[model samples]
Target chain A: MRRGLILLGALLALAACQQTPAPRQALFVVLPGDDGHIGAITVNDGKREILLDRPYAASESRGGVTAPVQTSEVEVRQVFGAALAARPILPVHFRLYFQTGSDRLTPESDAAYRAVFDDIRRRPVYQVEVVGHTDTTGVAARNQDLSQQRAASMRDRLVRDGIAAGAITTAGRGELDQAVPTARGVDEPRNRRVEVTVR
Target chain B: MHKFVWAGVATLALAGLAGPAMAAGAVIGQVKTVAGQAFVLRDGGRVAARPGDAVQEKDVLETGADGAIGVTFIDNSVFSSGPNSQVSLEEFSFDSSNFKGAMTSEVRRGTLTVVSGDIARSTPGSMKVKTPTAIMGVRGTTFAVQVKP
Candidate 1:
């Protein structure tokens, strides 16, 4: 009976140690975005609020209270290496310029579009949004048609490059949305362009 | 368990009616990359996740000790979770015209990293993450969360 009691006491002690585990913790860290800009984060734990605005800024909340702390890239990598490495490909944007009053791509833009096409090909699954714009030199209605033609032309090239037809969407903003605001009937090279966003 | 089985049946029926591409709920994102053992729990059914798989709202992502998964949302928001993590997409919506949206995710355990996108940029504080101990709000930023089990 004495031996049994000793065993029971030892088991109870082990249980006590197991039950007093470390307190639950939640850590939040802010980092620079893909665009190289740092934004802010707000953490609320019902009873308190903490703000982390700078890159590598960090905080830990325990038992519903939080406080800010210093962190470095090395620490972040040590803790979140897998999660960071698993980050998805960042969205890419391309602007292809067009010749004045036409849907034909400028020589420079023609070379640029090959890079965009190659990027789209590399992704196993991609969604493309092509928006075309025209300079203010032409009539609004005509510019709208020309802008749409420009977008459609780009879409056709993507389709020929083997992108699924359903994966691409096109829009024509025409002179209403110019890269450079200009007086009516002004020919702005920057405004006559097609913007493509691939994700 | 019975409730989950029934929910799975219902989801299967809806998928048949609407087709896979137009799966019952709104497809908020896609699984961009998955390594090792990862699965998406939807409507009580656990499906092995693969690249390009559509991720709907309310789906739970589970990653094993050797697993990791990345997701990219319609609003360009990107997120990924490390091994042994359970993350749930509680709510998500986006308006392409206005670039306004709200996203709320829950990290039950393990680590998650996110890069806020157009939605968070256009409407600061609209994106949030909930943990066992606290809630995090993103204001057009990149952030990471680690929830200890």
Candidate 2:
């Protein structure tokens, strides 16, 4: 019985020695708004000091709306690290407002778009999808057209900045797909936005 | 005698006007194939069509409206057209009858996709889709057409 106990203890030690540690992954999150209000970005990774508080300048207007300036490559890497650590790198959807029936980027969204551009540029193997959506206000047909135009405009901007055009696919879901639902004739600010996904 | 002659003339004019009106032509089919507007009939026939062409029976047809419409063909091909798209099916046909036919269509503007079925395969090279800038030939498969006007 003592020999058996010693054997069992030895087996346990061997098993413990063979155990592997989980991989170290990182995650970062940033929320930028149109009202010149840039939300706090947090990065959680051991051995890496990411400055998430960098201020992105506001730049040219899209569809008569000023979009926030583009984010740098360093910031994008931090965010990508965070996203990869949290989950499978599926596309994340965010809202960007535009002028009604126009493809111009708003001032607030410029910075976010820049960040997105930076992120896509850093990852060459990844593909980007830009889907535009609109609230239910006008005719469904017109809404679909407008939404598509907006999505295409955004895609053009990305391509101009050096991303391969083939890697991007733009779709206008129209009012048929809504991120936020509201009453009829009610213009929801959140609803009139573009959703971008990096896959 | 003069009044009698005038009444007969009026009757003849009325008959001529009513004859054609009763059988007004409809867009039988439209060209939605590839590279150009073309359609094939069920009996293994084909036609070349262009954008803004009227869709009629006996003509393979497709359409794009400001709204949505569900389209089905004799060969069981289904297609959906989004708003503001210009679509037309120009040809349609079955191959079990000896594989002799052609289909064609055109997209002036907008977006559309075809969910090709047995008909597309049975009739290879028989399907053609035309956009404003390019002509697409289908090799027994499904594809999409988007034209920016």
Candidate 3:
């Protein structure tokens, strides 16, 4: 019995000698959302779990999981500057109105067009989707053609503004999707508009 | 024309094997920005990545020592990675009408930045990132991850 205990102790000592501290293999940092809302991240390393709920909260794993820690913005910038710099801007949505029975833009929509164009131009790369909508003022078949014309016209305007024609796609949804639900033959300014989404 | 036809056939075959999240070559995202040497590995082929390139599920995004890349998903989620990185879009599905979906991405190595979009915002715990050591459940947040070799 004594010899067996001695052998077991020797095995334990040998096992201890073979172990070396493991290096940190990963790092995770939680940041705030665009609207300044701080969300949470639940991290599981199989053995333990961490909930990072605050901005700049961080966690790292070595051989074993570590407790959550509060990191600084400076550290994040220094460590993840390249990844952050590569992040693309979120999408933007714009609406432009049109005159009744015509593809011409209203005066107010014409004024709003500048900002939309500027926003698209400011991005390094963008994809524009122009969807034309019409009010329930005319027959569905004619309205479909009219909406298509409005969409094509808007696409032409963007092309004229120097935006690449290949980067923009246009679609027309006739009185099917009215901004304001209206009875047949009713003209709704809100529905007679083109929506542009830039990404 | 021949290449396009073969590609469609291959996509259809892979879609059958990829389960539900992938449906006959659906475009899940687009490459918004790329610098230096970035590439997308899809279906056993590695091609240089460029802005405006379509990104599909099961694609592996890789960056060289001097490279960086950014991708924007249909759900509005954004993912960017620094040099010497390998990230795989394991699974993704989005419903435009409801703006709800589930996504899972795995970072094999290097640095990654994630901005959760409608998927995580509309349904918490539906978006996740997997690393060598841990799995993170993102709840409509922006976050950074680094994996060392």
Candidate 4:
């Protein structure tokens, strides 16, 4: 009876020790300030660090060493806080230009698209949520279609550039979700934009 | 003689009209993946399949209105169909011990992405997606299929 009791106690102790605590995985968003500068950000310990280096000058090619501007720490706690607050540091906005009543992308938007592509390419594993919007200058139905097409075009470009298409989700908000509210006939440059969130 | 011939001609025309009305096909399932649009019905429930579903030879599949579906074959390969697409499974068969079969699908419209799975690697040329414009045969890679209506 004594042996049995001791064995039972040992088994209970082992069970208690074997129990594993769940991992702490939290989502965070990097919110850029109005000046396009990211404030303090948080990330998990195991999460990979993002290196932000300044663009190399043409003369820097001759030198073997390139100076980095700064390094930011991404902590899990901050990530959790931001996720709770529903904001991100690097918020992307695309101003897609069209030939007046068409969904086709114009050449003027190419440079802007390249910038977006470069941002995505810099971080491969990041998932993106794309919301397309348009100015209220056109018919409601037409605006809806145009916005969707614009979002799709951006998605295709990203996919072609070797980004996983699955990681990106696209939605056309039409003129319903406007950045800058304007009258029906007014042209709102900010409204004709696509917002991309990388988290 | 002339009256009898006219009656026979009218009967044949009526049969033709009735045949088309009775030949309507049913919507078996829906597409639930990105850029994919094919699905199959099993046990009265829509199987939003990944590439891992065990398939036998001659399984009939169809796409939902969105024209996107996901499938995982026995070998764990994933594929998805886009919206407004339709694909009929021409053939499928697999066994864990012996993984070998052929799968042919017809994409009537929309887009599809085939991510090479185990089946494509083990038995090359066994998987083929036929579009209205061309037939896509998988070697072992990710490729998209788009058919314009």
Candidate 5:
């Protein structure tokens, strides 16, 4: 047991070596949305600090907002835009495929599911939208049912693994969104999949 | 906070609409998104960066070990830098109406992502994103640039 502890300690130290320092200075333009869902962050237990809900000019390590000595409307107006030309901004997206005609995850997708779970676990406030898709081989209605089944299956697994059910929203694409494009009635292994977007 | 960032931003928009165009060194952008502790070192003063804060030319943007930020320039171009990164806007000129101007930013270290906007679209070769190893000429495309630590 002591030897196992030592190995674990060594592994953690190795992981720690990969993290680089964060960049503090940047200029941004808020995209169109209610309160702009730019991104969310959670600090490591001791070393992380985050600034939430506001357009940040700069923030210190203790979550302190920096006051700009010089600022003017022409400067601000130069950046903020009219809502007329708003462009949609997208966040993180992950897709995992299912076994043929079944809601069960293929081996590769099972591994992907675990990786995504790790990401979800890191955020203090996060929501995931998971959509399931299927190959075009089946009838339209049946494909819809299978796709939803796959979504439900993944949701259930997540809940069983201690993730909050409320954190997830599931939908079925019914073979409508294919990862690898295929013709009608074609059985594309890549088309049978689930897409999870986490933010 | 004596004044909110959005309020400052609103006034800026009104000023432009009223036809008194800003001088060359006007605030060109705001800090759109920040995760973790990022800071701006300007004129020998250091300030913590938050979303909505105005950004100017020649400001040195730095990220702490756990910090990262996303910036939207006046021309609607987007730039994001990953942790332990350092970058600065070298030159910026934009006429919002026609999106006619050029932008140059240098990534001294770490990772950066850029999405070309109106300026690049209108003037195909108006923007250049420089990293330590190579100079990237952006022409209306989304791309990521990284420098090994």
Candidate 6:
């Protein structure tokens, strides 16, 4: 149903290539913007010109009736994937913070662990990077060992969650790469964390 | 000779961008992971997807109940589609060296998250995702969209 329109658009693009081509119109719309909350989206399909003002503001009212007829529009994507099919996909990077001195995930970040798992499970990610960091609070040497323990704990948890243990690589940055830079012996909650990159 | 000349020009243009050498039809990205009942529809045909499957431009992607999928594009743009969502990649043009290009896709229903890439970073206005009522001109590093069906 929706697929026909997309095919028609592509065929038209090919046909137009032979004729005096119009600025290649996408079957879908491409918006321009200046601000985040207040902006405009223009939909010009040759004949129809739509200037939607503050579309985000209007979506709240019209969201209930949302359904585009064309269901499957794919192709422009394959051109890239097919072009570099041989190149490896880059790993996805995610960061989760922990408690100040403990290896336990922060209450907020613990909730975020599900999202990280979802990302891992969505793809055949062979490499999982779990690097732990700590606030500049303790001795640098001890912080390194503590951070490694934190990293190893995350690795095991990912394994228990179904990812292969062999797929994981762990490291501990200790007091390095603090989210909020501080002088030595400073306690920063944001600095205590594990960074995960899945490939 | 004309075809050869045009091909030569295109090669030069692509070389300037350090673009990937594309086949007659290229696959822009691949499905890195899939869960539940996700499907890929290409050429009017629908099939379930698995890890390491390629996702081409002009392909319609959908996720059923209990389904989800993650995709990574050549330009480093990542998309994650949640259950009951329909998405399409309508247009894309990327220049590798300058990292300047445009990408346009649409989601008909459900949830989708896009992690921006070179195209969006270099030219923020070039990345767009349209839903039923609104078109999103992505400006941030990452964003999520939810369209009501």
TM-score of chain A of each: 0.82, 0.54, 0.73, 0.51, 0.56, 0.58
TM-score of each: 0.83, 0.34, 0.76, 0.33, 0.39, 0.42
Docking quality category of candidate 6 according to DockQ thresholds:
incorrect
Q: Pick the candidate with the highest TM-score.
A: 1
TM-score, structure 3 vs. true:
0.76
B14-110 per-residue lDDT for model 3 (tens digits) = 8668755333468888999898999999876788999989999999999999999999888878999999999999999997645689999999999
Model 1 residue A61 CA deviation (Å) reads 1.7
- Per-residue lDDT of candidate 4, residues B1-149 (tens digit): 99999998896578666555322233211222322334554433345544323333334444555444554443444445445554555555544333465566665654444444446667877776664433445554443444444
Which regions of candidate 5 fall more than 4 Å away from where they truly are? A1-199, B1-24
Chain B TM-score in each of the candidates: 0.85, 0.54, 0.85, 0.57, 0.80, 0.81
**What is candidate 4's local distance difference test score?**
0.50
**Considering lDDT, which of the candidate structures 1 and 5 is the better prediction for this target?**
1
- Write the residue-wise lDDT of candidate 6 on B1-149 in tens digits: 99999998986677556754433446677787787888888655588987767778777789887777778775677787767778998887886435688899998876676556668778868988876655666654444455556
lDDT of 2 by residue, A1-199 (tens): 9999999999999987897433211112232322344433222122232233333321212222222345544643332222212111222345678866567777888777878877666542445668887877878888888889888988899888888897677888888667687766667667777877654
* lDDT of model 3, residue B74: 80
* Candidate 4 stretches greater than 4 Å from native: A1-99, A106-108, B1-149
Best by DockQ: 1
| Model 1 Cα shift for residue A193 (angstroms) | 1.6
Q: Going through the candidates in order, what is the number of backbone clashes in each?
A: 0, 65, 0, 32, 39, 28
Better of 2 and 4 by TM-score: 2
TM-score of chain B of 6: 0.81
Give candidate 1's TM-score. Answer: 0.83
Better of 1 and 4 by lDDT: 1
Distance from true position, residue B134, model 1, in Å?
1.8
* Residue A14 lDDT (model 1): 97
